[model samples]
Target: MKLHISFKISAVVLVLFAITVGMLVDVPRLDILNESIRNLFYHVTSWFAMVFLFIASFVYSIRYLNSGNEQHDLLAKIFVQVGMVFGAAGLVTGMLWAKYTWGAYWVPDPKLNGAAIALLAYLAYMILRNSLTDSLTRAKISAVYNIFAFVMMVIFVFILPRMTDSLHPGNGGNPAFSGYDLDNTMRFVFYPATIGWILLGLWISELRFRVDSLSQKMNDDLDIKSDRLDSIPRLDEE
Candidate 1:
């Protein structure tokens, strides 16, 4: 099979299998807790993917700054967009889980707050990218902003949460990955889910880059064709 055809089929098959597994799997009951832990698979996986994409975006941002190449900037932008999608998914999943477990859909907990702020910072990154008219200016400005947003995301989501009191474990002096939280069964699925989601995010970012490049090439070709036509003169005898 051609590579394109094979990739399309494989993507469809993987997504369908993921849905089936997600629907059929039984969430394990921990100790006396009967709360549904199924959300952990999607929620935690999405956050993992988001973190990986954000890190990739930051790396590309630095590369763009060092080399002044638009390719790095383009990759950085696409990865940030992919990260926002995963972050949004994580936020929605977290809210649902919190509602069931904490008796509230939304809480002012440090982890939740920090996650929201981090999402907003990236959203601003997109906004900043769009606001600039010149390509070079946009690349430089967005690169600087990407670096700042990355630092803020790390500080708010990872560092600050560890320092404060949070309803979520791993925040407010309550470290995450507690013994109570991890089990053999959860780990078996959790590790794969994390890797799978990261791989999926990278795949999506790659597609976005191809789409952007293709569009630019098409527009350039159209412009060249238009100029060629304009250079031709119509006969006045007619």
Candidate 2:
């Protein structure tokens, strides 16, 4: 696997350092959340990173539609793929934090359910995209779907959660972690953690795109050689 220099390795090291500090640093033991407040560094930051990744994907999709550039289409797909992983991580960490705070890994809150549905929408993209065989058709259709998926994600993750009363913080009139929980102290770790994860996501996406590009080139070369060989006169055909 080739590591791309575009993301830079120092960012990864900084992220690791930030994570270590987040783990060792003392956090406020607030009501219900207790020691689990440390999860703010990870759970919240992962969602932040996921949102950034999805936003990039949405932008690339739009570019693909306007310019008809296959690179934009590829970027749109790669960002979605990486965003989904971070989204899943956020969900899992939230579940664990919920287990500690709410006493259940699964809950009936609108926020939680909406997040799950949003992820499902993106997962459908992979399935729908692969079902198409033509590259042009696949790119156009997937680009349009990416825009739809981003809208769906915003509605499910942000809009719907606030529409109803819920146990989750930042929902049902409850103040968000930043409003009352996160202080300047936590921000030191939290901000860096978010930046680190975003950089890491971009790094991974770059490597994946490079691998895909090389694979596509190899396939195209093979197709050209096959065509050239077929054009030569065979004894039977002659």
Candidate that scores best on TM-score: 2
Residue runs of model 2 more than 4 Å from their true location after superposition: 1-7, 227-238
Off by over 4 Å in 1: 1-19, 22-27, 31-35, 173-178, 181-183, 229-238
Displacement of residue 92 (Cα, Å) in model 1 is 0.3
Model 2 collision count = 0
**Candidates' C-alpha lDDT:** 0.78, 0.86
Residue range 1-238, candidate 2, lDDT tens digits:
2345655575687589677998898787678877787888889988998999999999999999999999889889999999999999999999999999889999899999988988999999999899999999999999999899889889888998899999997889987777754557888788888888898888888878877776676667668777676554333431
Candidate 2 lDDT score at position 99? 94
Candidate 1 local Cα displacement, residue 162, angstroms = 1.0
Residue 84 accuracy (lDDT) in model 2 = 92
Give each prediction's root-mean-square deviation over alpha carbons.
6.1, 5.9
